[model samples]
Target: MATTKEYRLGEFTFPRGWFMIATADDINSYKPRQIRFFAHDFVLYRGRESGKPVLLDAYCCHMGNPLGAKNTTSYVVRDNGGTNIEGDCIRCPYHAWRFGPDGKCNQIPYSKDPIPESARIKAWRVVESMGAIWIWYDPEGGAPEWDAPALAEWDDPAWVTPKWDNVGMLAQHPQEVVDNISDYAHLGPIHGSTVDRYENEFRGHLAIQRQCGGHRTLVAADGTRSILHTITTYHGPGVLISDLTGLYDAKLLIMHTPVEDGSIQIWHSLVVKSPSGAAKAGITDAVTAAQFQETSLLSFAQDFEAWTVKAPCINGMFVPSDGPFMKQRTWYKQFYNPRAKERDYLDRCEGVYVPKGVVPYSEATVA
Candidate 1:
């Protein structure tokens, strides 16, 4: 039975939002990378011509076979739509239908006239910045356009940052990943006490703060003391940056790219404040080398194990000490609630969950 539900990662029925897809390396290497953003089931291909980056669609709508997964074909097709640096078109493997980078079916082997304009598949709105590619997933098309989060240091030459990048599966909703950032209880156990007793509270505003680089941290208070998280998000929907105060002398930035529904491709940028002379001598080179060697492997393995094993959708579970989770629940409700402004009056209803400051259920009900 195919349910209208999109994800099978966990108990979660994922609502529409932008998700992280891939890291910079995944698409920038010699071989092009193909990624799928699950919320809308959109696929992207990072094609290049003369060393220039081009991101386009991968699947053919006519037959559903992947467009350019092999080397036998030109790997790019020309649609009647338009051609870019990578060429005007490519040939499909299954039926040999031609497609342009714009995802139009240029020609059918037997048909004389070109494919219709309505037959073309869609391409994502990709923004490349801070060494990563971000895609927008706007289901209702109501998603507002915003600038990428400001990261001043990316262009600075003086700073040397270590990086760990990888793609992995998370048996959870996108919201679960974001909620983990503010969930303090798990930090002590899962992250090995990296975060201490953090107090989270609702500030009831789009709380934004400047970080070390051009990254700005945003927090919206829900209800829990531990759920108040500092999230570094860009103007678009998909990119997420987290400044880890515990890793690499306490200055590391994590960028999460949505590849699809069940997983994410990550870029871990470990920015150090400064290093000693001996460490600084070859430290940048050393750290970059280690990133490809040890750090990336270790971090990916650990996170993969942690998130996959836990209840993927963690909101329903009641843990008295999980203040952060509680807070995030409130945030989630507020974020999706259409009547958020009038939610206070609605709290008077029976059995409807409300945050602490809202009228308590005990007071509203007769004992």
Candidate 2:
């Protein structure tokens, strides 16, 4: 498996950002779900009383037992009244030790001794947003400084509910996948799109790619190609939100979470505007939304198919029309380095251009 160092990404192996771990519906008060990301095991669960989400290291600090273990007869659940979780804390299956939401060991059953200060696990900062559960990961153990990108259309009554796809794990690094945003040369060969104008912008932790193109195959039956104007933004290193217009007003959510050194888990979703505006009347048309979702997924699958088969691109030969690959890579390095070293990277790289004073709905303003 190829590592980030092999690709020469930066100083850190996993970049810092709010990466999606699971959907909002995936976790509930019933039982804790075990998930793996950044080469570490984590337990995700919702508070039985507070109803808020919590993410903690999977291992119990007392005896190294899995907190979210399934199909096991252990003291945490079997001996402790058959319930492994109480309120916001999860009890260890081996020793019946209870850890709070703050990852501190609070209870040790049958032992009169007080819980030691070292009896604690690491708890991650998590938030529920955009129909997904996002965890803030900082190697330096820092808090989130910026808000996740907001999808305003999600709340609009005219748009339908967002549909999602769990693309599963791919044997490729995220930098290779992220490079596709600024990869202008592949538009024609990969997705059958011809570019008219392409530009990329780097703003602190954000990288934006604006493309004005025409799709050759994804057009009307009359073979009339519709011009596509898209604004793709990278909220940090993990979440990508693309606002697309032309054939349809749509929003595409793409999330990449690193599962290991070289592999990543991907999730994508699409939402389109409703024609009849029945959503305003408190009615959701599932049929129309499903039809549009199929078309969007078909297009996204093409990229997935190609990415899975190709070898990792450690170094690439560049051309003038290849877009801002170098600049984007430099911006990506900011997440890998500490806050102090981020400026060193920005000083050596050039930031791309983002069109100012252009409305998204107007096609005439694309040029």
Candidate 3:
């Protein structure tokens, strides 16, 4: 797999940002989920006591026993009716040494010997929102510089909350996906968009793309099409949220988190405003929202298909007609480099851009 060094991303193999670890529904007290990302293994579970998410290194320090992996034959597990999870803590199946949610060993089960302070696992901080859990991953071990991905619409009663579509992992590096931010030309060729106007902007942590056009896949089945406008922003390097106004007023969330150096996990979901415009979304609104999400998923699948098989774009023959790919690439470097150098990278890329012959989004209309 091509690594971050190969792409010259930065000194760190993984960029620092808030990455989706799992959905709220994924973790349970019955079985901890073993998750792999950033080239490390982690155990994620819902603390049975607080009902909050807890993340720890998969290894139990007392011994080499894998904490979250299933062990059906062990008495340590079977005695607990199939799990070693003890309230907010998890007991090592091998030695029965229980570790608290803070990743400290609180009990030795059989020994009166003092539990060394080092007899613990590595715990991670996680925040839950938008029906998902996110970890603020930083190689520098700094607190989150910004808020996790969220939208007020997720809390609005009139918007139907849709389930996340796990689009699976992409073998390609994230640079391939992040490039889509300023990709003005592909919008026409790949998605069959007849763009009337387009523009991209870079400001601080946000990479914004605004466009209005007629979309092919998002239209009605009987060959009816309407003007679609999307104001999309990369909240950071990982989360892409597009507020769309077209057939339905909706917000499209396309989230990707690095799993390995050259691979990333992508998820697609959409929150559609009540089709009936009712103040509170009804059962019928939910059904309509599901259908709309299916259509939106189809749109994202178009991009997913190409990224699945493409080689890395280490060097490209960029032109003025193309979107500001180079600028966006520089913007992405901020997350990979030290936070102190963030300004240096941003100074070079932060600005509004329009392709050579395109009308700016602020000036475009369907007519």
Candidate 4:
């Protein structure tokens, strides 16, 4: 695995954007769950009082105790009936220092000393959406430039909301994962896609790919294969949502969050429109959606297989026919840099591009 410095991605080891830290199910019990992301440990839980998701730097300011780590011995946990969580606040198992959702110690037992302003941990801004919890992580610690992710069809009854597939951890930099957006050549070999048209575009934080072709995988429930058209876009640095058309009209999500400098955890899910074209999805639609999700996971696994052991492409021997690798990389750099330099990077990369000898997904072109 290669470090962010190895790729010269800019100042931040992790990029600036919204990233998934845990699935909504991970906190359904309302228990504090320990999570690691962006190379730091954090405590994630649903606030009992506010009923909202909260993320805080895992360790306490006093004695450096982990507020989220499970402990059965501490009276705090024992008295709280197996949890140190008190409403929206968590009491440190070591010292019983209660921290509010804002991460400030609001209560300190025994000692009468003023609650020092320094007695606190960093609180992360988080949002619960689409069965996932997301944090707006910025190395510069700026407010979110964009809202957390959501799918319109997620609430629509006509779509079957499939459970998220646990793709597990990958020991590779996210840059390589983002490279797949413009990976035209890989379609045929990796996915067995007989590509008829392909193109890519980079605009601001969006790296998009538009392609359509016949595919060997991702067949219909009846085992039918047809031309697949997908318009895939990276919402920021970590979230990927693809609108797919072919065997079924579905919204596919492949999201990854940096676990550290050179590793990430990934998840995949498919929200498929009801096959029966019913106004509301039923058990049969869910079964079909789950099956299609598995097929989608299989298709994604092909790329995961290559990413498992491939050397980091610090500098690729890229070619025109290989898609716009450099431009895609340029677009990725914006997140690794200060917000001020975002426009500079976008100026260099924003535009539509079609690989050499391939027909554009759309007839329009930019200079």
TM-score of each: 0.61, 0.91, 0.96, 0.97
Structure candidate 4, residue pairs in collision:
none
Task: Put down candidate 4 lDDT per residue, 1-367, tens digits, no spaces.
Answer: 8999999989889999999888888894346988899889999988887889989999999999888888889998888878888888999999899999999999999789999988889999999999999999999989999889999898799999878888999999999899999999999999988888899999877899999877887644454546788999999999999999978899999999999899999999999999778989999988988888888999999999999989999989988799999999989999999999999999999999999999898863321
Model 3: runs farther than 4 Å from truth?
219-225
> lDDT by residue for model 3 over 1-367, one digit each (tens)?
3678888877778888888878788889889988998989998998888888989999999767888998898899988989988899998889888999999999998988998989988999888899999998999999888898888899899999889999999998899999999999999888888899999999998999999888886655464448788999998889899989877889999989999889999988999999899999999999988999998998888898988877788888899989999999999999999999999999999999999999999885564
With a 3 Å backbone cut-off (N, CA, C), the pairs that clash in candidate 2 are none
Each prediction's Cα lDDT score?
0.43, 0.80, 0.89, 0.90
TM-score of decoy 3 = 0.96
lDDT (Cα, tens digit) per residue for candidate 2, span 1-367? 4899997877789999999999889988657889999999999999888888989999987778788768346655765466677898888877678889999999887789877899899999998877789999999888886886567787777788775688888999998889887777777887887766677777887888887767854444454437777888888899898887756677888899999989999998877777455656234455666666777777888898988898887788876556678788888888888988888877766466433333222343543
Error (Å) of candidate 1 at residue 337 is 8.0
Question: At residue 119, what lDDT does model 3 achieve?
Answer: 90
Better of 1 and 3 by TM-score: 3
Per-residue accuracy of model 1 over 236-271 as CA lDDT, tens digit each: 223444443322222345545444455554555544
What ranges in model 2 sit over 4 Å off?
79-83, 217-225, 278-284, 353-367
Give the winner by lDDT: 2 or 4. Answer: 4
Q: In lDDT terms, how accurate is model 3?
A: 0.89
